[model samples]
Target: MNALPNIVDSETGQGLPRYDLRVENHGPSDLEFEIWQIPYNGTPDVKKPLRISGLRGRNLALIEHRVLRLLAKAGIHLGGLNIQDQARYALNEDQALNLGLLFRTLAPMRNRENMPMVADGIEAMGKEEAAYWLGMAMHRKYPRRVLMALRFLLIDPKARMKD
Candidate 1:
């Protein structure tokens, strides 16, 4: 078994779904990412952690664009958020931290280049949504693996069943 590089551990006590992300570079063009979701209430099972893998960088970007377009079409007034030159929308300290961690985990190679502009688009995406898009992107090539990821995301046992 091979180990991944830059495996970021999740922060506890945030009451948010913890994200454990691992990014491994197989080559100049090939990369693999594994995201483990640690529910706030329980310990993550290491051996059976729900994994979303094989999402190409291009695909992830595509999903990001689609999401932005959809939001725009919905009349959300995202003008300030779409500013290309600078960060017109201020992210408080915590969102800034989340953005940095997510950007590094998702696109480590491009982390230093035009980060503020790129963050303009994805800064609104919560961690779980980012993970979901990543899983959907992987589903483009590997369908079966994404099923487990879907089940994990869609079914929250703690939520009470509606009548």
Candidate 2:
């Protein structure tokens, strides 16, 4: 069975997730990319690890939106946690790391060359790139920290729960 590329610890030889991303010209100056979520041996640089080349796309809006909804839903499941803990957990570095990992698994997509979302005629995106845009959009609209996002999501997990 095929697996994503990852780096393993040199000492332990234990494999771990590692990302390899690239953005460059694909056609006549239009940008494209090659991205991988490697499950490599401890030392990716030193080890000749296998890699998986994920599909490329012009945008990740759909996947990101879906992921955010899913994340909020998962958090909502843990209703036992108080608001303070829930909000705090949302901002925790470890949570961010896990989210970062999740970002690598999404497939890429495309858009019209002149569409408002992306008129640049781009052809690819890294798994989490859409999440970056989503974050920026959220910040632009709300302009706050984790607790605010947490509160918003918890109050209505269905708010952003798009299919």
Candidate 3:
């Protein structure tokens, strides 16, 4: 099979990806399956969407893996502090809102590369929100490692950067 020629722009020296297009005249059968690189204005950003579309699943996994590691490390470190009873405290509505907001703000920055930002997000929360997160750690529904991490974050947010 013949490869499509590289289509490029004359002015900006930009290039477009090649495509294999086949067209045939069924009645006369004069034309057969073929492809080409035509010089025309095409969607330059078309490949951009294609590149990003396949990244969602992989990116989610990356984020989740990073979060798990981060939380696990936090939990281990906090265990050193030796707060066995792990008392819970009442949370303010505003603090809850702030905690949600913090997650909202960090969701986009998820990934191993953006680990530093995670700590920054935690620190951005007011003391009230941090305290609320500490309470969340006491709940059985939350993963033990992540729960410990949250508790440690409330106590020492700086540990986030260490990851």
Best by lDDT: 1
lDDT of 1 by residue, 40-151 (tens): 3333443354443324465345344543353345342334322122222222223333333344334433433333333443455676665455546444586445434433
Ranking by TM-score: 1, 2, 3
| Deviating ranges (above 4 Å) for candidate 1 | 1-16, 39-47, 52-54, 57-121, 126-163
Cα displacement (Å) at residue 131, model 3: 1.0
Candidate order, lDDT descending: 1, 3, 2
How far in Å is the alpha carbon of 76 misplaced in model 3?
A: 21
> Highest TM-score, which number?
1
Local error of candidate 1 at residue 129 (angstroms)? 7.6
**Cα RMSDs, all models:** 15.2, 18.4, 24.9
C-alpha lDDT of candidate 1 relative to the true structure: 0.40
The better-scoring model by lDDT among 2 and 3 is 3
What TM-score would every model get versus the actual structure?
0.28, 0.25, 0.22
In model 1, what lDDT does residue 163 have? Answer: 19
The residue pairs found clashing in candidate 1 are none
Query: For candidate 2, which ten residues in a row score worst on lDDT?
Result: 114-123
At residue 41, give the lDDT of candidate 2: 52
C-alpha local distance difference test of each model: 0.40, 0.35, 0.38
Clashes of each: 0, 14, 0
Q: What lDDT does candidate 3 reach at residue 50?
A: 22
